[model samples]
Structure formats: C-alpha cells, structure tokens
Target: MIAVLTSGVALGVHVPGLLLASRLRERDVPVRVEVLERLLPPDRLAAVSASRDVFHRDFRVARVGQRIASDPVAAISADVQDELVRHWEECGVHTVVVFSGFWLSLVRRFMERTGRAPRVIVCHVDSVASPSFRKAGPALPGTEEIWLASRAGTALPWTIPVTREPPIQWDRREPRLLVHGGGWGMGTYRDRAADLVDAGHDIDLVVHAVEETGPAPGRTRHFVLNPAWHPWLDDGYPPLGHLLPGRSPADVSYTRGRTHHSSFDLARAVRAMVSKPGGGTLLDSLWSATPLVLLEPSGEHEGHNAQLWCDLGFGVRYEDWRSDAFSPRLLEKMHRALLSAAEGPRDLAAALSGSEVSLCSE
Candidate 1:
C-alpha cells in the first residue's frame, strides 16, 4: 500500500494517518507516503517527516515533483500518476491512501485504471472549519471513506474523533510549557514567550522560528525556537505552504534530521486539536499533560482552538500576549491541572494524547 499526504493539510489528520499507516506496516503491510507536487511546500513536508523519528526503514516512499504556485491540482494529479505508475509496476500496490482536500478528476482515473492500484482512501486532515469547507465532496468512488478528526458524527468511511491514547501519568514534574509556531510563524511568538516569563511561570518555550522573525529574547531554561520540532509533537505537523515565507528551511530540516525526542522540536507541531474544543495543539498539551497558556491568533481557527480548551476547563487564553492584563489565569490553571492531574478524567486526557497517524483498508 502507498499513503500520500497532501500539502497545507492539518497535522492532526496526518499524525493519525501516519500512525495508522505504521501499524499496517508492522503487519508487513507495505506503506509509503506519496510526496505530491502541490500538496505542500516541499521544505515544510520534508521537515515534518524528518523531525519525527518516523522517517526510518524502507517506508517505500515516492516523490511527486511539481510546483504548486503554477497549478496545485494539476501538479498533485501528475505526481500521483507518476507514483501510481512506479509503485504499480514495481510493488503491485494494493491500495492508495491519500490525505488531501478537493479531489481531482485525473487522480480518480489513475485509481480506476491502475492495475492492482489498490483501494483509494482519501482523508481530509483539517478542522471541520478548514477553508475547503466541503468535507465529503473530495471523496471518490475508490475511496473507502473520509475520516473526521474533531467531531464524533456520521461522516463516512471512518469516523474516529481524536484517537488520543492515554498518557503515562507523571507526578506533574516541573511546569513543562510547549508553544508552537503553527505552520506559519506569526512574528508575535516572542510576545507569548515574554508574557509567560513576565507572569513568572518559568516556561520552557519551544518554537520553529522563521529567520526573518529571528528568536524570542528572554530567559527560559529550555527554549527551542527553530524549524525542527515538527515530528516529535506526535500530533503531526502540516506543511508550511505559503504560511511562512522566504527561505525553505523546512525541507532542509527534514532531509537531514532524525526523530525529535521532545515536543519543542518542529515547525507546525499541532493541527486542529480540540480535547477541550479549541484546536489541535491545546489538545496535545492536555495529552502530554503539559499545562497550557493559549495564545489567541487573529484567525478563526486559532480562536476556535483556544476556545475549545477553555470550554473544556483545561487552559486559559490571552488576547494579547504583551499586555499588563495578561493575567495569572494560565498560571492558576497550570497549577490546578498539575495538582489534580491524577484526579481529572483520564479519558479526556487520553483524548488529548497523540496517536500515530495511519491509513486503513478494511
């Protein structure tokens, strides 16, 4: 089987997709992540697989070499065809697991015609509030079904709502605070770091700092603000796409690095996690048992992500990270979560934990 992850998609979707794929591979089920042309920014995709320890073994991967700025769908279709032809001829692939948004007609043709092409499974790895909006429309005939990550509802092929496994209950060690740069570094991350320090939380800030944005200036014991934490977040990191501009550090990071041992190690670590209901990263925090100080990005997704966690009674949010009114809300929550960490709903915590992403074909 071959699994293809598209560009600019959600890490929540991809993490589970890859975990599922890995499980299949363990069963001697051959799996490969098809690198599509327009699916994502090449460098960003590379960074994700590279930073995560998952890039090992034969993996049977293929790369689709086309540019997205020109024509995204066409580039994706071309690459899929190329991979299909090669895999069909060499491996007799039995299935094609694709993670993407908006299906293309040409891809449908390849799935329909490829000899032993295998069942085509396409999953849209994004929050229901993703831009594409149309969730079920991208699925094709060969597609087994679409997997919905956030909500537990009627979707289709598979409906797994955040397959977060339980984490080993640690006795709330030192306050471990994890901050992500999303797929794009919004230049305001420095403020986040500053706020935590100002509040005397003594945080360990991890970010994938874009060169132009430089690094956050402050004193944190373990500050990792680089484009190298993608894979370790365990939530899967989405490709940066146009989110981060200029240099292509993501690809450089992925092609050369190994799996990160810590969460503070990638570009876009969390997707759309919502254990409490806001977004992917916050959920990851709950799963990792790390207390959170939710930063409100200007976008709806970030606000929604922040709100989810807040509603679930987990984390606190600040509209402006650089204000006198930053408040001690997050600090209070962290202490509370840590003190009663063992007493909280283990299921809810598990729902925030990370699962290896994989594709299914049953």
Candidate 2:
C-alpha cells in the first residue's frame, strides 16, 4: 500500500495529492490519502481556520507569521498519531508521498517508531519549496524530493493530470478569462480581473467573498467560493457557485465533478487564466491548455513558478500581455505549447509506479 499525505491549508497542495492518489488507484495501487490537519488539536485548528481572514486582510503580515510558524510549534495529537500507526501497519504501506511539508516530521517519526522505513517522496508543487515545505526546515534525511514545476526549460513529468478532457481547441474556447487567486484567494487577481474587464474582456471572476464587487453589466460573471469554506473543511473542491447578479445568497448552489476539482470545470471553457502561478493553477493551465496571464506572485517560489511557465512558453506575465493589448495570438501560441506538454505520454503518477529515481531528480 502507498500513503499519500496532504495538508488542508493549501488547496493547491491537496488537489495534486488527490490527483496522484486517483491515478495510483487506477494502476491498482492501494493508496490512502491522509490529511495532516486531522491531527491538529482544537486551538491549532481554529487558528488555521481563521488564517484566510488574516491573509485576506493583509497578506504581507500573514506571510511574516507563516515564516515564524514554519517550524512545528504544536505537537501532533497523540491520539491521531497512534491511529495513524495502526492504520499504516494494517494497510502494509511500503511508500509515502507527502505533499505538504509539516507531514515530514510526523512521517519520519512513524518510520522510527515502526522500525519500518517506507520510501518517502517529498512532493514539491512549487519551483522550489517556500512558505510550506521550506517552513518545515528540510525533508526527513533520506526522502527523495520531486519538483512538479518544469526546470531549466526541461519538462519533467511531475505535473499531475487534472482532467482527461482534451485541451479545448483554441477556437472553441469562450472569449473569456478564468481569473482567481489560488487556494485561499491570495494575490492581486481580483484587481487584475478589474483591469481585464476594463480592457473589454469577458471574465469568469472567482471571488472569495460575495462582497467583492464587480460591474455586472459587462461580460463579467461572478463565481463565489463559500467564504466560510477552506480546504481542510472537506477533501472535495472549493464550494463554488455561479452567481446570478442581484440574487440572494440562498439562491447560489455549489457543485463539483466526481474526478476533478470544479475550478477545472470553469477552466475548460475559458480562453486563458489570469492569476498567480500557483502549483495548482499551473497544473490546471497545463491540463486545460489555457494560457496563463500571470499576476505578481505571492512569494519567491511562486515567482519561480511564474518564470518557469514563461520560460517554457506555457505562460506570460500580466504586464507583458497587457502592453500587447491582451492579444488572442499570444494566448493561442501559449495554448498550443501547453497542449503539447499535456499530451505527453507520461505523468508523475505513472512514473512513480515504477519508482524511477530519474523522475524524482530532473
């Protein structure tokens, strides 16, 4: 059996973990996906639940807090730890894929306690670890780290396939952009969405809160993520609902696909995605063949992700596209580039089944 671990904090991280687990299951690999947040005690969980409010109010300060709290300050619940040990033993687990950083310490301790060292894959979604994995200090001594992002213009097959849908042909895509901040609604995407609308573009604006206003008269349509919902709240996708402007909140309803996150549902129809280069966003852009018009990154790792995407011709910076008047030509070219990459014969999950060290390295 294989253990796939993820944290609920970063929806970006959790989604890939799910995608990998799903793929593993298709290969008849028995996989268990455990969310680390389940080990958090009440107080720690409360703090995590409220973190989005802090991030929304002032991202910079929230980021500073992230740096200070990177190291494990609270203990993993003893009960959950005991439960995990028993479960892993029962499952006969031989490998572990950790998507979130904090899980490393707990996983390392598990290896020590059981005197059974499962091969650990430290799966990094960013071009490099930051905020999350970087916060955890480093991997458990011998764990192999995998970069899901492209490196040095070399496409390493680590990007997980989000959907089986063929990349929507460029001409068939709606003349609209899917715009949102990744996971917790971090970054300048809302403002960028406004600018895109002002520039006379159709938009599927993903607003974190219903209160985030946009002009309803134009081609801008609102999609609201339940403000109270966070990744840890459930294993499923964000609670997303298409908004009918001027309707009461009760009228909006959330829906999701069985296999992929609902955001990918929105992504399938858009011409491009205007957002920060989050790992999940990149995965979505890559699979959907949607060109990314990247906004200013929220952190250095994301900045690197943005650069890697641009370097590989999968994306472009917001300013560059803006200066060019948001040409469909720019998007179409990147769309073709992404389609080529997505059509690759292999992906991270398939490579991992063979336990190929080369897949982990480059």
Candidate 3:
C-alpha cells in the first residue's frame, strides 16, 4: 500500500493530502494516511476531518514534539521515527509519499537506520523559495522529488503526472462572490467583505471566517457564515436583506442563497474568489475554472506563488483590499482569463497514475 504523510499543521497541507488520498482511493489504490497530530489543534483537525469521510478508515494519527534543532535534517524525534516504522509494518507501506519538507530528514534517517525501509517520494507542495526548502537542505540522495505546478507552468524533471478534475455544475442565476482568508480567518478579509457590500455590488456573498462572530454588516441581506468550529453560534447570523439600503427586496431575494459548500463547489458558481495566495486554494481555483482576486502575499513563498498566478494570466493581484483594481472592468478581464485557461485539462492525479512510481504499485 502507498503511505501519505503530512504534518497536518496548515490547511494548505491537510487539504491537498485529503484530495490526494481520496483520488488514490477512487482509483482503487490501497492507501494509508499518517497525520502529525501535534502540529494541529483539535478544531483544525476537526475541520480537516470534516472535509472527507475517508479519514476515519484510512488515517493513522500520531504526534511529535516541537523540533529542537535549527537544521531540519536533524529534527526528527524518537517518537516520530518509531511511529513511522510502526506504520510501515502495520500498513505494509512500500512507498512513503511525504507532503511537507519537514519530514524529509526524518525519512532519510529512517532509511539509513533500517536498510530495508520503503522508497521515499518527496512532493514539493511548498513554494520553491520557502524557508522549508532552505532548512530541509537539498533533496535526499535517492529520494524522488516531485514539484506540483500549475497548468500554465512546466514541471521539473522529477515531476509526477498532474491533471485537473472537471468543474462541478451549479445553477447560476445571479452574480455571486465567495470570500475567505485561508484556514485562519483574517480581520482584513472581513473588512474587505464590508467594502464590497458598500460598493453596491448586487451579488451574493458566502463568507467563511474562523474568528469573526456577529451579524452581517452594512447592506448585506443574505449573509451566511459556516461556524465549522464554533458550537455556541450554531444557527448562522440572521438575514437582514431588508436593512440593505439602495437595493430592492427582489434583488436581495434573487441573490439570497447559502449552503455549507466546499471551495470546489463554490468555485463553480462564484464569479471569483478573494483569498490569500495558498497552494491548495490556487489549485482548487485552477481546477474549478474560477478566477482569483488574490490579496497581497503574506510572505516570500506566497509572493512567489502570486508571481506565478500573474505570469499564467489566470488571476489578478490586488495589493490592498481598498484598491481601485476591484473595478468591474478588471473583474471581467480576470473572469475571462480564467475561463480561457479552463478549456484544457490539468489533472495532478492523472499525472501520478501515469508515473513509473504509480501509487497503486506494491
């Protein structure tokens, strides 16, 4: 069986792991998932679990203490090493696919300690310029490395097969906008949502935030926030479409639609997504043929990702939420660009299937 290992810390990491695992299983490939529980809190873990039903049957949860070394190559703990071996034997894992670079050193050390260990495959999901790459050192001696690339880009020599899934079909009667700030909600994102509402855009807004708690602001009539973690606020915020000024009730009613839809589903229906430049988010947008109005990069890695998005002409970048770049003309241009790119297939899972090291192999 193939084994997929992930730190389970960031949604960016966990979401891709789920998608990969699900895709593998869909292909009738036996797979096991190992989650580093210590890196993720209970709520985030719950969010990850809620994303897929396969986790209950295929996941092997474990924990590791915080790293005490500056060099990532030497950062494996005794517990983590022991757990890896245990899973290898229990699951009969012949190939270890690591989603994050943090585990590369540990896997290498395990291989050295146990000469018969399974082959290692490092899937570089992080940006090439990220600190993770710097600390993980160069690729391990015999390990196969695969870089996940967008359709507009070319993969490296060690690239695995990458394919895009077909977009979901949704009934689109009116313009809709989906706004999110990655896993951890950002206050700035909420502020931006308020700005869009003030701009008098007659579109439905599906807001996903982790920290915010309150009713919808300003002229928003059909506001729905899925409290995936918060239990107290079980019922979503009340609808105040009538409170919206300068907009007719019929307009609010026409756009009033809210359900706990996944990003993939929302991408099919929404005009565009406003989010941070994250790997998982970017891939989802590309696969769904949805346009992205990316916020400013949070760091060097995201900056690099944003550059790629711009280069591919799949999305537009705005430095600030309040910028005039959110004009009607720009949004139309971005939407058209995304649709143009969506005409072709871009499937990462199909790429993996065609690889010499197919996950289905023993």
Candidate 4:
C-alpha cells in the first residue's frame, strides 16, 4: 500500500496530499494518509475531516507529534516514532509519498529503524524560490523529488510537472468568477466585487471570506472563515454584512455551503478567480485553466509566485486594489488568457509516476 504524508496548516502542502489520495483511489489504488496533528490548526483539521467521505474512502488517518527543533535533522519523540511504525506495519505501506519538508528527518529515521525502508518520494509543492526548496537539500539516497515549476527560468534537479487539467465539465454559459483572499478574507476584494457588480457584468460571484456568516446577493454564499494566520483581518476587519451592499440572489450557484469543498472542483466551472497569489490557489487555477485576477501577494514566497504567474502568461495582476474603474479592456485580456491556458500540455499524473513505488490497484 502507498502512504501519503503531510504536515502544517499550509493549504499548498495539505491540499496536494488530499488530491493525490483522491486520484489514487479513483484509480483503485490502496492508500493511507498521515498528518502531524500539532502543526495543523483546528480549521485545517476540520477541512481534512470534511473531505474524508469523498477523498479518503478506505484511507486511514494517522497523527504524529510536532517537531520541537528548528533543525532539519532533529530526532522525533518516542510516541511519534511508535505511532508511525504501527501505522506502517498495520497498513503494510511499502512506499511513502511526502508533501512537506518538515517530515523529512522523521521519515529518514523511520526508514532506518524499520529495516523495510520504503521508497520515499518528496513532492515539493512550494515555489522554487521559497525557503522550503532552498533549505531542502542533501536528501537521503533513493528519495526522489517532484515539483511544479512556478517559473520557466527557475530550474531544479527534480521532476517538474505541468498543471493537470481538472476532470470536470465546464458550464459555457455566463462567465462565473470565484473571489477568495486565500484562507483569510481580503478586505479590499469586497470593494473589487462591488466594482464588478456595478459594471453590469452578467456574471455570478462566489465570495469566500472570514467575516461572512451567511448567503448574500449575487449568489454569494458566505463560507465560515478561519483566522488562518491573518491576525489583522481576524482582529480589525468589519463584518461582511457591514462591508457588502445588499442585493437579490443571482440565478446561479457555485458552492453548496460545504466548508471543505475542493477549490479545484469549484474552479472547473469558474471562468476566473480573484485571489491572493497563494501557492495552492495559484496551482488550482492553472490546473482548471481558469484565469487569475491576482491581488497583491501576502508574503515573499507568494510574491515570487505572482512573478511566475505573469511570466507564464497564466494571469493578470490588479496592482491597485483601491482603483474604482474595472477596465473592460483588462477583462478582455484576462478572458483571452484563460482561453489560451487550455491549449498547453498538463502532465501532473506522468510526473508523479515512478518505477520504485507501486500503487496497489484492486
């Protein structure tokens, strides 16, 4: 059996593992997932549990303790070591696929003590310029690395995959836009939505915000928000009801109010996404061939991702969030880019395949 592992609350790390497990199950592959519980926030854990029915069938969940040291080669606690060993033996896991850098030391030790040293594959989900990739070096022998290159200029000695096209039918009716500010709500996007609404654009808006508590106008379903490391928004941002003007619900719908619904699934029908350049959301947009209307990135790594997005001609950036004019000329350009994305090759499955690991099929 194959085991997929991930740590931390970053959607970039967690969502990839979830998607991989789902893909494996779709192919009738036996798999299990292991997570480091202490590193994940409560909301992320809830998201993982919420997705269990759809993506985690026959998949077991295991938790390990958080690492106490900043060093990459630190030793794991006895409790964590024992739990992992039990999971490996019980599930008969012969190959380990990891999505986070934090688990590298633990995985290496586990392989050494178990004597059955499973094939280890590290899937780097972050941008090449990110600290995660820079610090990840001198990997144990027999370990392979897989990544999706953020920029053509950035090169790494690993398998770089193209974004995979999502396996969902598109609705070619009125174009729909998905508005999200990463996991935390972007207060500026509320104004951006108003600008679009005022333009008389015949489109549906699906907004994901932390302050929104219920459904609003334009078929906007309020998804419950998590703090998600955005302290300023959690502490100071006004409630959604106060920020957004009331309007009648639109005829269309995107999400059915599930808190843990996959963004990739939603992107299939969405013509464009207005979001911060978060790693997970960016990758999702690429795979769905959806155009991005990017807001200013939240961090240094996200800034690198934004540059790559522009370099690849995948999306356009809205530099000034305060600008009231939503240019029709810019919208046209975004639409053209969205159409162009579908013409390219997307080989995510081929990049993940390897000879050392066997994904069991029924």
TM agreement with the true structure for every prediction: 0.56, 0.92, 0.69, 0.66
Give the better candidate number (1 or 2) by TM-score: 2
lDDT of 4 by residue, 1-362 (tens): 88877653444555566566655655567777666644344675465444432221211121111111233323345775767777777888887787766666667767777777777777766465444444545676677655554454342223222224432334462366666655434325556666665554433343433234243556453433332322111112112221233432231222221212344455556666777677676666655666677876655666677777776666677653225354545544545664555445333343344344432210
Task: Go through the candidates in order and give each one's C-alpha lDDT.
Answer: 0.40, 0.79, 0.53, 0.52
Least lDDT summed over 10 consecutive residues: which range in candidate 2? 66-75
Better of 2 and 4 by lDDT: 2
Question: Model 1 off-target regions past 4 Å?
Answer: 2-4, 8-18, 38-71, 76-83, 102-106, 115-117, 132-138, 142-148, 151-170, 209-261, 264-283, 297-304, 319-362
Model 1, 2-96: lDDT tens per residue?
A: 55444333344344445445445444655655434334446645554542322111111210111111234543435656665665557655555
Clashing pairs in 2: none
Instruction: Estimate, for each residue in 1-362, the C-alpha lDDT of model 3 and write its tens digit.
Output: 87777654445555566567666766777876665544344574465445332221222221011122243334335776776676577777677778777766666666676676676776656445344455677777667656554323462122221234455433341366666655433324555666677776544444432123245554343433343332111221112222244443334331212321244555566666777677766766666656677875545566677777776665677554247746655655655665566545334455555465543232
Look at candidate 3 and tell me the lDDT of residue 169.
38
Query: Higher lDDT: candidate 1 or 4?
Result: 4
Off by over 4 Å in 4: 38-76, 129-138, 152-176, 184-221, 225-262, 320-325, 328-354, 357-362
Best by lDDT: 2
Query: Which parts of model 2 have CA positions greater than 4 angstroms off?
Result: 213-215, 354-362
Runs of candidate 3 with Cα error greater than 4 angstroms are 38-77, 126-129, 150-165, 168-173, 202-211, 217-261, 319-325, 340-346, 357-362
Model 3: how far residue 354 lies from native, Å: 4.4
